[model samples]
Target: MADDPFQSRFAADASLLPHMADLANDRVLVALLAEADYRAASFLDQRLLTDRVGREWMAWDALPDLGAAAAGPHFIFHIGHVGSTLVSRLLAEVGDVLPLREPMLLRTLAQVAERIERPESVWSPELYRTRLAQTLGWLGRGFAPGQRAMVKASSVITAVADDLTGSDGRALFLHVPLPRYLETILAGEASMAETLAQAPARMARLAALLPDFPHALWQLPPVTRVAMSWLCEMATAQRRLPPDDPRRLWVDFEAMLADPAAALMAQATHFGLPIDPARIEAALAGPIMRQYSKAPEHGYTPDLRRELQAQAAADHAPAIAEAIAWVEALAARYTNLADLPILGDQSVIQEVRCSS
Candidate 1:
């Protein structure tokens, strides 16, 4: 029999090369990347991909209906700086799952969601829904048979969390409590600085959630501003999560670090991944856990992280203290957030509140 184009995974080009979709014009533009450089870059920087990789384009309207295609792809949704990428990388050790780390299409759809309510909007909710469904269908395509697709979405895309994990799909929401979030950001070389710099743009989109939000939030200290963004995203995810839904799960980054193997197995079971007990044991003993999940070249043991966080907390005590206070003050404004496992416990809250 002649070779089917789609069956030839390497030659299918669409399946082999990474692709980014743009919905700017009257039509959608699908740009296929031709190089393997910077596979670790954020989906938002996908345009820079053209500089390194060759490209090919396909108009969105010209494509056939993908709505009826696979719909149950898994997702790793998170607040920024949590260990989501680590979890995604670990999950890929399972033989049957193909993990996609922040696809550009998802970021595009998410950006679309942000502008959905604009006055001069050219896109309607229905159109957005259809496009997302089709785009996800294309992304869900497994590079090889029997391999399921899992996506680690960008934290900003949490704006579309519910839409992405609708009836067909399942997801895990990863986050840390307010104090740890501040600690992680502060410990990083430039993550906190970068987040602070982008506050105006990110806060503009979140203003509707809190009355007089953007202006009010901007008045706060730089540390407090970043903390507010974390709370906003967490609050959004909390509201969208349905009670007693087996398809959705909430995980604490701290807990995962304390006992990684248990966390991985539980997550695997939750996602219905049939990883063998032996394989799970082997993976835990492997080198993946020894290095930083995002920057595999660097070492990132739990002890090292603890030392760094402790040092960071001590060094940035004044700023971290102010940021924690800001978070507690805003907690009442989001009572729904108070019910979360991370935020609800007054003991945990008080502990962090009194820290430093």
Candidate 2:
């Protein structure tokens, strides 16, 4: 192989080979990656969000398949905004648990297993099964016997919980849907439409290969619109399953972020995890606080806000009214800034939230 001579740094430094070999061997890299992942700065953490997924369950189906029981004590966490990242990062600090962001272990096994058939498209189910077990074994290689670790996964996997649970493993579900998190990223003088527009190009290529889906939807702009569609799709699917299934949990992000100390305590108590106070505080104050504080104070003129509210009301009167009522109810649940005192009217923000 070396005789073929593809000149590169790969040949220059044999040390680099050790890192790759260790990663292939599933030794140093996994733990190192796990630590580096949790320690990453706020928006850049990419723990659960290594892609442009906006940090939620909708991103799960997009991941490579790992057959059954790849992850146990499954944290089918559905989250909204950047705050969910903070929560996840904090959870990793617990000594008993090795908080996996999105582990490549399972998928790596799946890929290798699939190689047996050497097919161009899909692998046989048996190969997938083989790979899945191999991956799970490797995941626990670093853990002390009888020690348990949890996988915090994207909620999109809610559709496949039965495939994931095993007699040896348990599951815990958590939700952290920020009521107005989309606003943080979408509404800053930066139009959601603009963010969505970039998505079509990416979706175009994806649709060609994933013909099971409608290509027409690919025309929808990328970031905001495409992201929103995935959320609705995944969230609706998750809601359909019974809560008793041990397959899911739902959290209102605004509620948790409003008082994380209390919320964190409740979650740890409920989920039966160690409460690592120092880590929790570090995560919250580190990334989430910085991101929200630095978020743009996008100035939308009163005239513009008024025009938008009026237009939204006219376009969908019943839905708009229903949304307003929902907001009122939500405001009561999350008291502080539910209806920002600075706003001219509640209806204005309602238009953005409901976008009816």
Best by TM-score: 1
lDDT of 2 by residue, 281-341 (tens): 7655554443332132333322343355355445445543343343344345444324322
Model 2 TM = 0.48
lDDT winner: 1
lDDT of model number 1: 0.69
Clashes of each: 0, 7
| Model 2: lowest-lDDT 10 consecutive positions | 13-22
List TM-score per model, in order.
0.84, 0.48
After superposition, candidate 1 runs with Cα above 4 Å error: 1-18, 26-54, 211-215, 242-244, 341-356
- Cα lDDT, model 2, residue 310: 54
lDDT of each: 0.69, 0.40
Please list the residue runs of candidate 2 whose C-alpha ends up more than 4 Å from where it truly belongs after superposition: 1-73, 79-82, 105-121, 140-147, 154-162, 165-181, 185-215, 218-233, 236-242, 275-356
